[model samples]
Target: MRLDGKVALITGASEGIGAACAAELAACGARLSLTARSEEGLRKAGPGALITPGDLTSEDTRRAVVERTLERFGAIDILINNAGIGSYLPSWSAPLEEARRLMELNYFALLGMTQLVAPHMRARRSGVIVNVSSIGGKVTLPWSTLYSATKYAVNGLTEGMRVELWGDGVRTMLVCPGYVQTGFQKNTRFGHAPDGVVKARRFAITAAQCATAIRRGLERDARTVVTPRSGWILVALSRVFPSLVEARMAKINGTA
Candidate 1:
């Protein structure tokens, strides 16, 4: 469970939580392979980290990233599927194509990368797969329904894979972070902040905080990580008081 000298491949490493995870893991002495659509922002991952800059939604890109990571490190001890896209519009009014595009990057790309890396992890009988979902995955947010749906799928996939890989000595961690300060909101498709979103941004945590939780989860062999320590209360409320939770979400989305 010690990350020292272990090789970790992190997607969406150009910035935000992904970059933070790379830096934290490197500080833990883990060798890193960082991937993103652009190389410029990846420099924050620090020196000597392998950078695979490309579109992760493409099969060729996923394959190349894995192959090259293996080529350099000989084995992947950890796989962090962090590359994702999000939508801020209401699902019913959103363009169908745009929804599908979000799914392609957020869900399918995560699945594709896991599939490519799982066998190697299984063969080695020791590895970790971290899927970066969201607090929205645990509790649907009306304003970003489609984005929530994609993350919900990731939650399910990670849970199932965790059980499947249990006996193989491979581990899966579901990271459901509350709102964090990052360029994520700015980069989201059709993601202009509305009044409610603007109000919510005031409470967002920093990306480094989320990254710290992820690293600690890996060390402790945790199944789920809810960042800022308090996000878990929302998850619990969603489970025990679904109606109330939905009402709160409605209020937050300015629909109440």
Candidate 2:
């Protein structure tokens, strides 16, 4: 979709890829509605954006965000569901409460935002929905299995939405970013990545780079976007050699 003069509502706009997307989209001449739990961070992310700072997991917050954005922008031309958290704990032993909380933000909150905005888009018959998933969504990362699960769900949701919204002229784009240079590690809900995974950051791409890729994908109406592009190699390997991929992931998680 052409972003010029469009209104884009982006969640988790406080930092990292979300923040970068806010800037990138704004640069593309799209009016911005930025939201996150940190008002201060949102301010820095989009100085001229419509800011709605709150926990997206709360139904009230979600309603207020959508209501306020529509009030200000008249319409939401694009919905970027980027608010999510990670869990580094082993899925088998992770606290159930923590897992549920992670799912609330990463999955449920995204669905809620879509539910609120999709009707408006459907009526207009024009809009783009961008769901920020992870490469781990396509190929499980044993070190962050719970996080992977949430992204896997996101992938499914994005794909289904694409088909369901096709007749309406609404587009859904799934973004699978490999290790990004963000505060993701420090801000995870709980636990730390294994040292091997931490070291892999040296090869990670910047949030700005990922944001640029997202914008390019939208311009071309791409169905699935894998930032760094090379991440597709891993995804392909996982599909063609599942056991080999699983063994490598197990070694990364120190389980092999």
Candidate 3:
């Protein structure tokens, strides 16, 4: 996936990781098509990009975004499924509607965008799909269980796409980022994260750093990318010592 001169469509390009990716990809000489709910923020984040400002949860918006990107660039060499929202409510107690809405954007919308672009990529037999999941997807966050669920779904889908699309010459990459410095906490759709988790921002990587990792992953044709690298240690620990990890997470959520 040489980014130079390639057409990359990125969702959630308004601010945070998506915005950072837009800039990073452009710097790598990729042509950009950016979509988000904020027209103004997209403008700032992706200058000279084909901006489609709308809700990704809408089927029409998803279609128009893919159609318009092809209209402008003639081909989509890369798809970055980055548009997603978070929830802090416990899965058992959260409103069903809120949980549904979270899944709609974080999981369903991502799947919809992939479905729309996958055919074109398969036709060409060349493309990369990048799904922006979270470290929470690998090791669940007790405080944000619902949010973690969406990311876990993303991880599953990305893995499946990798195998399913490999014969077509299409590659899929899963990005699991640990606490990137962004407004994600402030902009979550539901309740706030526990104070301990919020205070952990001091140790988090910047969105730009996360974006850089994504770009590197694309260049190397990686299957999975865990930003900050060290996040993998946590993931490994969770797998080898599930009860220990759960206890620590419960403490972070102030539940123990």
- Candidate 2, pairs of clashing residues: none
Segments in model 2 whose C-alpha atoms lie over 4 Å from true places: none
Per-residue alpha-carbon lDDT of model 1 for 55-134, expressed as tens digits?
99899999999999999989999999999876888888888989999999999999999999999999989899999999
TM-score of 3: 0.99
TM-score of each: 0.97, 0.99, 0.99
Lowest lDDT block of 10, candidate 3: 180-189
**Residue-level lDDT tens digits of model 2 in 1-256:** 7889999999999999999999999998999999999999999999989999999999999999999999998999999999999899989999999999999999999999999999999999999999999998999898889999999999999999899988998889999999999999999868999998999999999999999999999999899999899999998999899999999888888889
- Which clashing pairs does model 3 show? none
**How large an RMSD does model 3 have?**
0.6
lDDT (CA) per prediction = 0.91, 0.94, 0.95
Off by over 4 Å in 1: none
Better of 1 and 3 by TM-score: 3
TM-score between candidate 1 and the true structure: 0.97
The best candidate by lDDT is: 3
Q: What tens digits encode model 3's per-residue C-alpha lDDT throughout 70-136?
A: 9999999999999988899988999999999999999999999999999999999999999999999
* lDDT, candidate 1, at 219: 94
